[model samples]
Target chain A: MSKDAFRARLEGTAAAIESLLDRLLSSSPMPGEIARPPRVLDAMRYAMLGGGKRLRPHLVVETARLFGREDEGVLRAAAAVECVHGYSLVHDDLPAMDDDELRRGKPTVHRAFDVATAILAGDGLLTLAFDMLADTPTDPDPAVRIALVLALSRASGLGGMVGGQMLDLEAEGRFAADGKPIAGSEEDTLRLQAMKTGAILAASVDMGAIIGRAEDSQRNALAAYGRALGQAFQVADDLLDAEGEADLVGKATGKDAARGKATLVSLYGVDGARSRLRRLVDEARDSLTAFGPAGDALARTAVFVAERQS
Target chain B: MSKDAFRARLEGTAAAIESLLDRLLSSSPMPGEIARPPRVLDAMRYAMLGGGKRLRPHLVVETARLFGREDEGVLRAAAAVECVHGYSLVHDDLPAMDDDELRRGKPTVHRAFDVATAILAGDGLLTLAFDMLADTPTDPDPAVRIALVLALSRASGLGGMVGGQMLDLEAEGRFAADGKPIAGSEEDTLRLQAMKTGAILAASVDMGAIIGRAEDSQRNALAAYGRALGQAFQVADDLLDAEGEADLVGKATGKDAARGKATLVSLYGVDGARSRLRRLVDEARDSLTAFGPAGDALARTAVFVAERQS
Candidate 1:
């Protein structure tokens, strides 16, 4: 496809993903006026709805299309994963956690609301994802749903994103750890990045695949796509942190080094990080070969990750 | 049976709950360091292992026995419920939330560890409970397991514990408002208490019924037991806060009114609250009549909840 064609597809896909997000956010059944609550819900809605590429949902849709089914059932599950992703970001930026006061060109959830509400809102969103998935019993066998639940839980819990966080907490200000150096080889850099960002991204794909009834081989390929794409996505985030415009990025930029945070560029330098990002995108696209022609969204998303400006 | 026989069952059941709590704490499939993150894990173990009544887990086992099956499966479900209950307390005591620096005669989790770790530790336990229930699929069908997942999520999320919290937050100075005596009725007070401490207590029984194959009538009865038990439980807690010894209660005592916190006594006079407590207990025990002889543990538990000291 031409650049224009791909761009149009991305815009249409982003719109579709936004509508799904709207369903997820608007569906909360909790009645309001919580403690005169300082507009916590407003903060939560602002952080989540104001900005997101929805790449994860897009991947879910593309992978489901490989199975030749694009029903609401599949889309809802896709949306649930995206909600989790949104929740993580909101909480990650909390004063007690990452402490950023800006998100998506708006006040961060914690700043807009209180820290307590931001924390609860993040928690509400996380539990809501599991609830949404568990509510739909499309998988007839008790075993399949069990597997899907386990997959998502493992991805979200201590061994995945949360675990990565513990690692981040421990590794901050360290010279070189987890086989990755402050200036290390590509693989070493990836090992560090994988635990930090790669695990959830990979789990996001496998979760959607298992629920959408992807075959074992397809699931494996999806996993491969997830790892490659996740690293590229992280590298792009690092690049944005290094050189992106504040207004365009919609978040406070240039804090990666200021906070002494670990990133590919921090480990491997900016040029090396850029080179590795291209390599990751190439491999991520190659992993889509198993999807034949049905992997267009996954492939296009990888390219977008490598080239994203902010 | 005499009091001796009843005491034996209570001790044995409490021991069983303790064993399950320890096993879950140390034996998850996650790597040791990842599963048990030092002080955070210690705080979780301490808060859960403290010598309390083991009220919720006992309800699960007794209710499961009510249905004539109390095997590994039911105990596992029971254990899972305790995990959720224990974890909620850990997070609820965090500085960002309730800010309790002490609990159950020991330091609170956030005070024991840091606030961030306490928050994540609680999250780990919450998801771990559902993961356990969802993984063991021998009894509850996918549909039923699906229901259990939804039920637990709702109980833990804003609609239940968190919703009650919002009320607790709103009710915080509600009594002293404008110095105009006290406002709201006994009905409103009961509803508030039911949501706060009562919802999950009730959920413990409702969950047992859901997982143990109880009939609709039995389930309804158990739910009533839970609601009434939860109310009585809250009332007992309130009484302790008013009149119990600090050492006896294992935490600060008589701090509720001094703190201007929400309690039945805060809404109604002390005499009125006492009378209401009696009525709630009667109603709670009355709900168990449908269970025939299967509800002995539940009946005894309701009485204990109404009158227990610390």
Candidate 2:
């Protein structure tokens, strides 16, 4: 498929996933008119329904198709991934964390509501994601479901997203364990980027494959594809941070360099980072051979990762 | 059993459970740790290992016993509960949240680490709980595992703990959902309180029962028992806030009154609060008849919850 057609496919997938999540979110209870605070509902709605690329969930639904398993089960998994993604952004923008004031061109959750409400709202969304997965129709063997839950949790937890945040925090003049600098070496930086951004993406694709009954080797191959794609995503993100317009990016730009946040450009310089990203794109494409022509969406995703400005 | 012996039994259960968690935690990789940062490790350790009373995990293990199921799988369920509880405490102490400087008479996670580290650590622990549940070896039954994950996630999430927090936050300001004064009714106060404290405690007990293959009705009974006990637990907590010696409480005492935090004592004076607590305790004990003597640990838990000083 040509790049334009591929982009169109991704956009379509994003819409489908967003609609599913919107439905899932609208179904949550409002405490009561006499007691239900609109702020809580507002915060929850803003965090979950605030539309983005829906990259994670798209990866899920598309990858599920590879194994001929596209069902309602993918919807639950999609919501679960999106919930985690939304929460990470909310928490990341908190005053104590990244403390950004804007998200997706709108005020961040803490800025929209108060700090406590945002915190609780994010917590609510995160937990609800797991609840969605846990409640998935048990047609998939219990063993498979357990593995799915495990992958989703780990992807969101210390080994993936949280672990990435810890490294980011510790790198910013905070000491690290064993007195090693939190950020050092090109390999270390890439590894951190992969775990933080890549792991969840990998989980998204790999999980869809697993749910669709893909063989173990196929799942592992997709995981490799996701990790490569995730690296490219971060590098593209870093590039946007460097040169993209804030309006197009939909949030603050140039903040990464300003905050001295340890990113690809910081460690490897612009040219070096781009060079590495090109390599990652190729690696990602190579990993897609397992899916054969069925990975057209993902193959286009890799190219988009390397070239997208935002 | 004497109170000390009873406390010891609970403590012992927690310790064994913790021991299981230690193994599980160590076995899981720290994702961002290429060489493993010490500060991050310390932060994770601080919030997780050797911290707080392992009440949630103990309840899980004990509840499993109530259902006549005791196996390695319970250990995984217990670990999941502890991880959630730890995550809550870590976030609860953040400067933006409760601003608690001490937990369990030790420096809180944020105090020990920085605010950002504490936040990520809490996030890590919370997600890790779900991951832990995914690894249960005994019951490969996805439905059982899924039930456990769903129950735990809901308890920790909005319809449960997080929701209760928003209510508590509003209550603290004496503002209802519409920015009006909260009703000064005992029913209103208990309703919110039950969702907050009661929800997760109920989940804790129900988790054990469900894992032990308890029928839905038995699970409901355990949930009711836990809800009552959990409320009693909150009542005792409020009582501590009001009447317990500051020195004895060791953690912060009277913070509820000082912060204008909403609580049973805040709404009802000491006598009224005590009377309400007595009713909850009686209900908790009465629910135990269903378990016959099998509910002995839970029944004893209710009595201690009603009478304990701290």
Candidate 3:
């Protein structure tokens, strides 16, 4: 697929996911509830809508499409994943966490709203994500719906994204229980990155595979593709932080080095990080070989990850 | 059952739940991982273990017992509910939220740990609750597990506890979007209390009923019972806050009135609140009439709720 074609596909999927999310966020999860808390709803919408490449949703859609299933089910599942993504970003940007003030070319949720509202907004989004997955529209089969919930819970839960965040916080010298610095080996950094970001992105693909009821072999291959792409995405992100213009990157650039955050880019330097990103993108593309051209959009996504400025 | 018998049963259940929770909190949710972030794990354990009334879990057990099923399934489900309760308290006590320094006789998670770790610890516990529900040991039937997941997500999500919490925060004059005081009518206070505390406690009973596969009539009865009991519990709690000593209550008292946080007790006055509490307890006991003597302990629980000093 051409880069333009992939961009168009990605854009369309993102638009669809955004519209669905807008409606989902606007309404109360409990139908009979009197009102949606306006402040939290606004914060949730501000964080979620009109932003980013929608790369995770794109992964969910393309992976499902490769399995010959592209419909409302995948769309709903994709939207749920994006909610989790948005919630993480909101929490990550909190004054207590990464202390990021900007995200996606706008003030972060905490900056846009008060810290209390930002926290509730993150909580609301996180809770609603599971609600969306379990609601009947996500799947006809209760078993399949349950599978999605389980997979998402594992991906987002402790030992996954949340645990990774805990490690990231420790690495920042925030709350080291034993009074020791956590910034250690490159392996530690890689492991932290995998948990913090890779888990959810990989789960985005894995969730689609589960929804599509992919065979074990197909599921494993897609999961591998997702994990590789996720790592590549992180490396590319770090590279952007190291070298890209601050305005083009949306948030502050060079903040990772400023915070002494251990990253692949920091350890390997720019040229080495770029090489690693290339190898990862290749691995991602190779994992999708069994699907032939059906995997074309996903392969292009890997390429885009390596090349995008932000 | 006599008051002594009920007290014994409640004590036994709390102890069992505590032991189960201690084990659950100590182990890494993901085994073989390099290391669980020690600080977050410690905060999670600290917040969850050695604490308050296991009233929610007891409700699960008693409600499930009404259907003649008493086993690991209810225990797991009950433990999951408690985890949600514990996590909510951790987040609620954050400096950005209620700003409570003490909870259950110790420093709140945010005070014991830092704000960032407290947030992550809450996040970790919330994620772990769903993970517990989804794990195979929670239920043998995938359909049953899915039902539990859906029920829990609804109970804890946007329209439920979190939404109630958002309302509670707004009432405190924190981030009311319209910049108006949210301390409104008694009806509004009841609604807020219902969403905040009542929802999850009610969910605890409903979850047990679902796991027990209670008949529709029984399920509705138990759910109604739970809702009434939850409201009664809240009123009783407010009474404690208004009238009890700090040392006995394990936290500061009279802060509710000082903060101008509307409550049923404040709306109706102490005597009126006590009368309403009696009526709710009666309603709770009446809902269990079909089970006769089998519900004696639950009936006793209602009495206990109204009469307990703490």
Where does candidate 2 clash, by residue pair? Answer: A142-B142, A176-B39, A177-B37, A177-B38, A177-B39
Stretches off by above 4 angstroms in model 2 are A30-37, A137-140, A174-183, B1-5, B27-37, B174-184, B259-262, B266-268
**How do all the candidates rank in terms of TM-score, highest first?**
3, 2, 1
lDDT of 3 by residue, A197-227 (tens): 8888888998989898999999989988988
For candidate 2, lDDT tens digit of each residue in A51-139?
Answer: 67788888888888788876778767876888898898888889987888988889999998888888877887788777777764623
Write one digit per residue (lDDT tens) for candidate 1, span A219-267. Answer: 8888888889888989998898988898888888887777666677777
* DockQ score of each predicted structure, in the order shown: 0.39, 0.50, 0.59
lDDT of 1 by residue, B223-270 (tens): 777877887888778887888898877888877777666577766667
lDDT of 3 at A19: 89
Q: Which ranges of candidate 1 are over 4 A from the true structure? A: A1-17, A20-43, A137-144, A173-192, B27-47, B137-140, B173-188
Best by the DockQ measure:
3
Candidate 3 chain B lDDT trough over 10 residues, lowest sum: B27-36
User: For candidate 3, lDDT tens digit of each residue in B1-310?
Assistant: 8777888888888888898888777765554233466778888889888858888899888888877877877888889999899889998999888899998788899998899888988888887787788777888887788788778877787778888888888887766566555666888788788888888888888888998898899888888888888889999999999999999888899988887778777789999999999999999999999988998987888888878787
